[model samples]
Target: MNYFGIIRPAMVTCLMLMLYLAIVVVSLITGPSGLDPQLLSGFSLSPVTGDSEMANVIVTWLLLPRTLMALLCGAALGAAGVLIQGATRNPFASPATLGVNAGAMLAIVLGSVFLPQFTGQFPVVVAFSGAILTTILVFRLAQAISDSPVNLVLIGMAMTLSLGALSAGMLMFYENRLDGLYTWGAGNLSQFDYQPIQRSWPIIGMLTALALLFARRLDMIELGTEQAESLGVNVRRTVGLSLLIAVLLSSTVVSQVGMISFVGLIAPHIARGLGCRKVWLRLLVSTAVGALLLLVADVAARLIPLLISDSHYSFPAGVMTTVVGAPFMLFLLTQRKRVSALATTPGETGIQALFHLSPVTFLSALAFVFLLIFGFSLFGNLDLQWINLRWPRVLSAAFAGAALGVSGLVLQTLTRNPLSSPDVSGLTTTGVLFVVLGLVLFPGLGSLEMTLLSIMGSGFALLLLLGLSRLTGFNPLLFALAGLCLSAMAATLISMVLVLGSNQSSEVLVWLSGSTYAVTSERFYLLFISVLAVLPLLFAMWRRLDILQLGEYLPSLLGVRIQATVAILLVMVALLSAVSVAAVGGISFIGLMAPHICRVTGLSSHRHLIPATAMMGSILLVGSDWLSRTVIAPFEIPSGLLVSGAGGIYFILLLLSGKYIQRR
Candidate 1:
């Protein structure tokens, strides 16, 4: 290797080692007052004697395990990221991307609620099993639709959301266990029980070792399966082995550390960029980097003083990653060379041959709408009888869904990427956080303030996103990727509001699942105002949105003021999205699904698609909400989870089927 490569690897390794030592030191140093035997006395000055009696006792009994858990868990994640990315041959890949973490988390949450017995005996086992099953299902579903690896990941994502909803449904039935579920969901290291370590090591070790051994082959796979096969590599075996490795590696890590984000997503990429291409180097470098990053992140999670001059400032490490990692990922996407993410539909089927109503689409959609209304009737606590106001719930759901549908449609059109929606873009999460923060800081900010602040936050996030793209010279695909990361981060940071909040916050989490729950007349009025506002703007720029989808140069050549048009459209989206988030907490997949359904069904024209999407969105939240509440009679699933369950699966189906292959 060249001097730069050699020096770079060494530098990172040294830094990682230093951080590792630092973690050991910190863990050894800090503890509760009366816990350590030697430190219990409050002072000590003997080498082995006092250290062992006090710090060692604390370390061995307390911090040692935590530190080791951090190291091992982080290492496993780093390796897993490399394995999955190499296998999928996509840069924008993560376990979360395929819904593995979401599904596993959902399962864990449900188990805590419905199957508390399992939580005691086989929590990790159940989580691993759930993750493995979902991964396989997503893989199979994707392969069945389209055998492309990238599409497989997308399908896997769909599976994640689908399973996530089912898991949510289970949680809804067992809301008594909601507190524990949320705590576990954060991937916190506070669960320092030692038995989990024994249960965990065997699986993590085997998979990580296997991955390391086959790291060279993985690098080959990264080179391109066809090319690797040309060089006498068994493409099928390599792919299988790589995927199996990923499953085991990730599952093992989840079983222990819960689900830490971005370690797997970013570690390997950074490792390779730092010149760890060879299996041995990549494995070691990634492990080192992972350990270092997680340790620091853990420390950051603990140490970053919430200096909010505001009333209640709370922070969590998991949230920190999203806040930090989201922007970092975006920056990475910006810095890296941009590639066309415009995957076209395969087989040259235009609106002519493939103009079908999206298989299982209409039924699923209608059923979802009907069930949401039905659900509204069942759920009641004290004076709150959900079933009584079915019409109001439907009305509320309709407006919220319409707003999201319009938001997603505009995002897709302006960005020209089907995946470009508020949820994916972090716009919704940012707006919601703004609302929550406002509530936290200044107690009685009326609904108007909430709406206005939501709009402002969304606008700021959008502006930063657009400006960042320009500064970094990133393409649309990368820009969207960055947005997703930021959104993920925002979601993480904002979750603290739920976790640390009083009963009111708990109510928000339960109700925010994109369902038609408690919508009164006033909220509907605001939503109506949002709808009317967007309509006129959309009407004026009818044709331009269509051409914008063609690409950057084509629209500009067609006399479109791309920048000005995009900015105006973004303002409309923010107004709509702010209204949506304010009305119905942050929902996922509706925007993505509506547009996809329209496109797949040959309703590509902006004129028809926009209105149709509005209808689709309205139908979706209402139907989904109905089913969510009525599914189990007494308890109700949130509309968000229900939609994610079904819609997520359908999304994966599209991804795997190569439905968008060259079709964009």
Candidate 2:
């Protein structure tokens, strides 16, 4: 309304745009060629005269294509985000929410794994298909449930997780085929020919036209469905059009670049803050902001190593954007209390009973999971029909499953966050890194030492989570965003270590997925001790945890030392997570879904929730392991990957069934 407001936002927009362009220029110059800064600066003034073929090729071919690709992809994603959050009125919505990215990922993964001949061109088509399917799934799922903007978002998240897991598992089934897909999954924008963007440009253009045409409807609808309807807007038709355009704009971009996080969340908010009022202005501003944000992230991804000599770091644009966007969003959330996304409410109070076990049913379910796991493990690539039966293999799968199951229980109990899991939190991966570091630094160290180091990593991760929670108000969605960011960071670091030109450390990647390749009686004994130790501790703290779950204040009045109890439980969770990580690889999401399964099965009490979560986790891991090993014999998938695949479905099912509202 004020002159200063108009001038300030315009100035900020101009400044950010200028800064973004400069970064792109800088990123275009930086690469793995080890080009010195002086040479690049010199080359800038020098026109294309291919005198030095290598330098010319690097600059003209590689750098130029890459930079342009980054700019386009970034802008597309950023605009996509703005369209989504604005259209849905949910901050949590992103390309990933609507399944666009994951569906695209699934298509690309399938191309690599199942259809090798089409690897080059198939990824794009597959990605497009995935994105389209994703939009349909999200809208349909939301329609089937409630059409509240928040419910659509939750459905999108559910679809995303399910599809993403399916994609990962598909890749695993064809890892030998899809070995180098992680970078693509990381949102690599290395090689592009401008053809794909051109193909989708028409769609993007149509979307822009629609957004502008329906600008007034958008402004009216943002008020609320009923309000818009009262104002003579055809709320249903306008929303349907908005949803269609948003999905098309989003998925088309996702088809090119794998899912880039936070672009959508950051862009529109920035655009509006910068004084864009009209729906068309917001969309346009968001488009420019999104493009610049992505370009800057890509450029920075390239620029970081140049700034630091001897640095060997590289990040995909998507990961880098998320890493930057998550904290900024958190800061924004804290500074302003009023929000558009789903709001959290404290849970209802009651005397939640712990005992919900029916001996006949519990045992029956256990038997079923056991029999299925046993049948699969007992008859894998390692045959045993005429030969003597191996007790070790059977026991190994069982124990590992049990470890995960229990780990999930411990984590869910500690956090009181349903989506909380060792896998979801990235503790499993971080813990693995630490354990590996310990093993490498102190050769021939005991299992206990490795486990201890891993627990330290897990504790460090939990502390990081706590600090993040404190800063971000501990919203589950934000926590998930942080976890995604952290996962990318850990993956980037791991990729660096794995490719360090040595087979010795490289081999540890086997455990990156849940595996029992070197299982021993001693290892099992340690796991047994860990499970026994943590179970009783969790049980002891049951009442306090229940009280703590009753929102943050009431526990203190119940004569509980809230801070101390939380600290201890947090440490215990780290211990449990670290031990599991040491035993298996960095499988995530089991902890998140296990607790939900428990709660859904009518065991909300900590006492029952704890044990139930562990059992559900065990069942999931064991079952996934069985599928991994048996379904595709002689080509074993990682147990963790498979569990994630399964758990992703369970997560989606929770959304479809409305169990998500309880957690939400």
lDDT per residue as tens, model 2, 1-664: 6898678877886887688777766766676744445335435555645444455667666677777777676666666766666567776677755567777777767766667677565555566666777787677766754445544554555466556657766665566767767666867667536566566667676667667787788888889889999999998888667766666666566666676767777887787787777777887878778778777777766655546434455567776776676566545545425333454532431222334666446646756766766666555445555113434434555655555655656555444545555666667767876776665455576767767877888878778877876766665545544554455455555544443323455456667666655555566667678877877877777788778777667888889897688778777777777777766657667776666555554565576656655666666666666666666677677777777676666665655565444422
Model 2 quality (TM-score): 0.82
Which residue window of length 10 is worst by lDDT in model 2?
Answer: 345-354
Writing each residue's lDDT as its tens digit, candidate 1 over 612-640 gives: 77778877777776666667767666778
Q: TM-score for each prediction? A: 0.82, 0.82
Query: Highest lDDT among the candidates is held by which one?
Result: 1
lDDT score, residue 569, model 1?
A: 88
Looking at candidate 2, what is the lDDT of residue 632?
67
Q: Model 1: what TM-score?
A: 0.82
